[model samples]
Each structure stands twice: as C-alpha cells, then as structure tokens.
Target: MHRLLAGFVSANLFFSAATAKAADLSLDAAPMFNWTGLYVGVQGGYQWSKDRSTEFFTPTGAATGFSQDFQPDGGFGGVHVGYNYQFDWLVLGIEGDADFGRASDGFTCCGGIFTFDARKNWEASIRGRIGVTPTDRLLLYVTGGAAFTDLKYSWNSIEPLFPGVNANVFKTGWTVGGGGEVAVTDRVTARLEYRYSDFGTTRFEWIDGSYEQHPRFHTARTGVSLKF
Candidate 1:
C-alpha cells in the first residue's frame, strides 16, 4: 500500500512540473510589438493622366465643341507624416503627404487652339498599412487610403484674328492609391507605390463666346522613406 501511494505522488509531481514549464515556454515564444513615434519622409516619381472634354449650348443660338488632352510625364517629390501601431507580425498606420509638380497637355475646338497646363501644387492622403516580418531584419507591407489634390487649368485661343483670348480655372478633388514598403534600417525604409487620383472636372468660359472643357486624372509614383 505504501509503494502505490508513493507512485501516485510521483506522477502528480511530474505533471505539475511539466505544466509549469509549458507555461514558461509559451511566454518566451510570444511576439512583442510596439509603434509609438512620429515619422517623416520624402518621395519622388513619375505620373500619367487622362483628360476628357464636353460641349454645350449657351443662352444665344450658337453651337460649340471644346476638347483638351493633357499628357504630362515628369518628376515629383514630397513629404509625409503619420503614426504607426504594431501587432506581432502586422503593422497598421495612417499617413498624410503633399507634393508639388506639373503635367500639361493641349486643347482644340471651333477653329481655335488652346494649351492646358495642369500644375499639381499640393496633394495629401490618409492610409492604413499592413505588413509582415519574414525575419528580424526585413518587413514587407501594403498601404492604401483616401487622397486629395489641388489642380489649376489655363487656356489660350485666337479670337476671329482680331485678338487672343486667355482663361484660367482652378478646382479640387479626392484621390486614392496603394503601395508597398520595405524597412532598410532602424531609421530608414524604402517604398515602391502606385496611386490614382481624380480632381473631378471643371469648366472654363471666355469673353470671346467660347469655352474649354476638361476631366479628371490618374497618377502613379514611387520613392523612399526615412523614419525617426
């Protein structure tokens, strides 16, 4: 009877020690994540845009058609700011940025020729980022959000060989895009992203009984980022 009692006590102690070791091991294997800081960075790349046109009748009995195409491909650069939150292998954040650049095209209708110059004075966005850590030294992520832009439109045309007519217009619209980022160091990260923005459409009326028309645009960019 004493031998059986000793055997039962030994089994119970073995299980108790095994349970305690498993709990300790679980705590050690868990992941630790944190992201509570402010970061700023700059990016630059190229953009492509599509323009559309429309026509209508005025108060007077006259017919007119105005169309313009803007194909501006150039370099753009800007700064960004936001806060980040980390969860194990996942990272979420919101960011805002602004850039200044120019993309231009031309317009023609009703026996007159006009050039449309679309300048991007500033633009911004708020996006969410999701990423994964394949190892301690590398991270890959995808981000997207709402965007906005400020655009200006201008035109020059001939008026019956008497004089030239010039008109300028301004408008604003919303934009959206997605991209990926890679952490190159503790304080620096690189990004390759594509964005699409639409500034809606606007109308330009001139004193020479004529007007110009335009539509929204889409832009894509890529560059690097520095975090601190």
Candidate 2:
C-alpha cells in the first residue's frame, strides 16, 4: 500500500512541473506589433499656396514696373500607397500619393491697371520616409521627394487694354514634410502630416509680353491605412 502511494505522489509532482514550464513558454512567445510590409490609405485636408508674378515684360523684353501677388487656399483629398521595412527601432519606406482640388485667387495690380488670376488643379508626390518607433505602436517620421502640379494663370489689362491671355503650366518641384503615425489595430494605422513644396520660377509668354512667376505651397493632411 505504501509503494502505491509513493508512485501516485511522484506522478503528480511530474505533471505539476510540466504544467509550470508550459505556462512560462506561452508567456515568452507572446506576439509583438511590427510595422513592416505594404500599406494603402486615403487622406484629405487643406492646402494654401503663395505665388508671385515678379515682373511683367513687354514683347520687346522690357520690364513693366508692376508686380502681382496672390494666395489660393482650398481643400484636397487623395490616396497613398507605400512599403515599409523595419529594422529594430528604425523604419525606412517609400510612398506615392495624388490629390485633386481647387485653389484659386485673383488680384489687381497698379491701381486696377492689371489683373491676374491663378488656379491649381491637382498635385502629386513621390517621397522617401525615415522614421523611428518611439513605442512599438507609434512612429514619427520625416519625408521628402519630388512634387508635381498643374497651374493656370490668366492676365488682363485695362488702361493699356492688352488682350486677355491664359497660360496653363505643369510644374515639377521638391517637397519636404514630417508626421506621426499610430497603429489602431494589428492591420490598421492612422497618421497626420504636413508638407511644403516649391516649384521654382517659370516664365510664361503672353500676347505682347511675358511674365516671371515663382510658386510654392503648404499642405496639411490626415489619413487611415490598411497594412498587408
């Protein structure tokens, strides 16, 4: 009887140790959130532009004494796709996005002698991002790259009575920005970002003369993304 009791105690002790080890293994294997792979998202926000016509030139290339400055502010929305590779606390990624909206403004120069109107149709960017994960689920990053946009300008004069002229320009430039992102779920994330773009100076030829313009803009946007 004593032998049987000893055998039963030994079996119970063995199982108890085995169960404790299994629990420890489970805890050690807990899953962690990772920011790697491809993601696609939609974003929307407001953008404001600052543009200036530095000088008006006659067909003979003589500069007019007047200059015009106009600001166009409006809203825009778009979709973005990107791929991220995470290395420990740092992440590197490439993203592309396109947005369309209206940004229009008009101004009169030289006491209503000359009138100028400007409009923007759409804009896009291809950018590289470098970021750090402050926490497993949060990332802060900076981005910069190429930017493209379409702009239309109209000019009219009264005192001189020059014919109205329209110019449509496609501008290519550079952009830089920064933002923060948070993981809402294992497969979803949210972000907010701001960017500034400069399209440089361009010369547009008109009816009897030409003008020089320098265009740049700022954008603020927010988005939600799905990871794959």
Candidate 3:
C-alpha cells in the first residue's frame, strides 16, 4: 500500500506540471495586435513644385503670351497627429499635418518684359492612411486627402515700366500619395513617403488683361513615429 500511494502522488505532480506548461504555451501563442490610439510626430524632407502661368485676353483684346517655365525645389519640415484602428495585420487611420518651408517658382514673359514672383508660404492637409503588415516588422501603405496652400504673387512690366503688381492668393485642393514604414521597435517606426498636391487655379485681373494660373507641388518626406 505504501508503494502504491507513492506512485499515485508522483503521477499527480507530473500531470499538474504538464497542465501548467500547456497553459503557458497557449498564452504565448495568442495573436499580437495593436491600434486604437493617438500619435504625434515630426517630419522633414524635400518638395518639388511645378508652377504655370496663363494669360487671359481682356475684353478690349490685349495680347498675352506663354511665360517661362517655373520649377522650384526646396526643403520642408512639419508635425502631424492622428488616430488609428487595427484589424489583424491591417491599420486604418486619419491624420492631419502642417508644413512650413520655402516653395517658390517664378515666370518671365515677353523677353523679361513682364515678370512674376510666386511663393507658397505654408500648407496643410488632412488625409486617410491604410497600411498592411506583410510581416511583424514591415508595413506598406497609401494615403490621400484634402489640402490647402497660401500663395503670394508679384508681377511687373518692363514696357510700361510700372511699379510691381502683387496679390495674395489662397487656394484649396486635393492631394494623394503612398509610402512604406518599418518597425524599429514595438513602439517606434520609421517612414518614407511621397505626395502630390494640386492647388487648383486662381485668376488675377489687371487693366490690360487677366491672369489665370494653377500651382502644383510634389513632396518626399522621412519621419519617425512612436506608437502606443
């Protein structure tokens, strides 16, 4: 009887240890998931802009011609904030960002007889981001939304040799882009993105004629973010 009782106690201890080990393994196999939080971060990079000049003939029939090509490239920096939702390996989020930098292009017409200085002071956008994680460490995504820009334009004529003409044009339009992100840690991510924005068109009227133009911008950015 003593030997039988000792054997039964040993079996019970073995079963208990096995059950605990199984429970620990089950916990470890549970799916890892993240999302549903707010995040804010800063970004900096370069922007390339294409600006065009359009001339409108006056009702009195003033002659207008195409101006010089305008292309400007420079650096930009900004901050952004957003909320995200997660479903399995997919993340969907809405974000808002504002950037300040030097974005400008100039146009000269009629052999430098008429010149215009166009500059964009600041810009902002609200966008939606959708990303899928192919693995635990890599994320691929696309983004698009509405954008706004503040622009200043100045023009001067040589024939008449008149004072410079200046106007402040505020434009609202749409933007779209795509990029990729890599996870450096459980809470940190590095990102590279490209975006294009269209500011529509604005018309400026003068004594001789009217000017109609549209301003477009392209940007490439790199940023680091902290995830909750």
Query: All models: lDDT?
Result: 0.62, 0.90, 0.83
TM-score of each: 0.67, 0.83, 0.80
Number of the top TM-score candidate: 2
Task: Give the per-residue lDDT of model 2 (tens digit) for 165-208.
Answer: 88899989999999999999999999999999999888787775
lDDT of 3 by residue, 1-228 (tens): 999999999999999999999999999996554654677788999998877777768785454665456887688999888887877899899999999998887867667887888787788999999988887577788999999988788888886746677888888899999999786776777889999999888878765677777788999999888777
Q: Is candidate 2 or candidate 3 better by TM-score?
A: 2
Give RMSD (Å) of candidate 1 vs. truth. Answer: 7.4
User: Candidate 2: which pairs clash?
Assistant: none
| 52-170: candidate 1 lDDT, tens digit per residue | 54444556726555444556555678878877767666667778887766655555555655444545555667676666666543456666666666555555555455444344444
| Alpha-carbon shift of residue 28 in model 1 (angstroms) | 11
Give the local distance difference test score of model 3. 0.83
Question: Model 2 segments beyond 4 Å from truth?
Answer: 1-30, 59-62, 110-114, 157-161
Q: What TM-score, to 2 decimals, does candidate 2 have?
A: 0.83
Off by over 4 Å in 3: 1-33, 60-63, 158-161
Ranking by TM-score: 2, 3, 1
lDDT at 177, model 2: 99
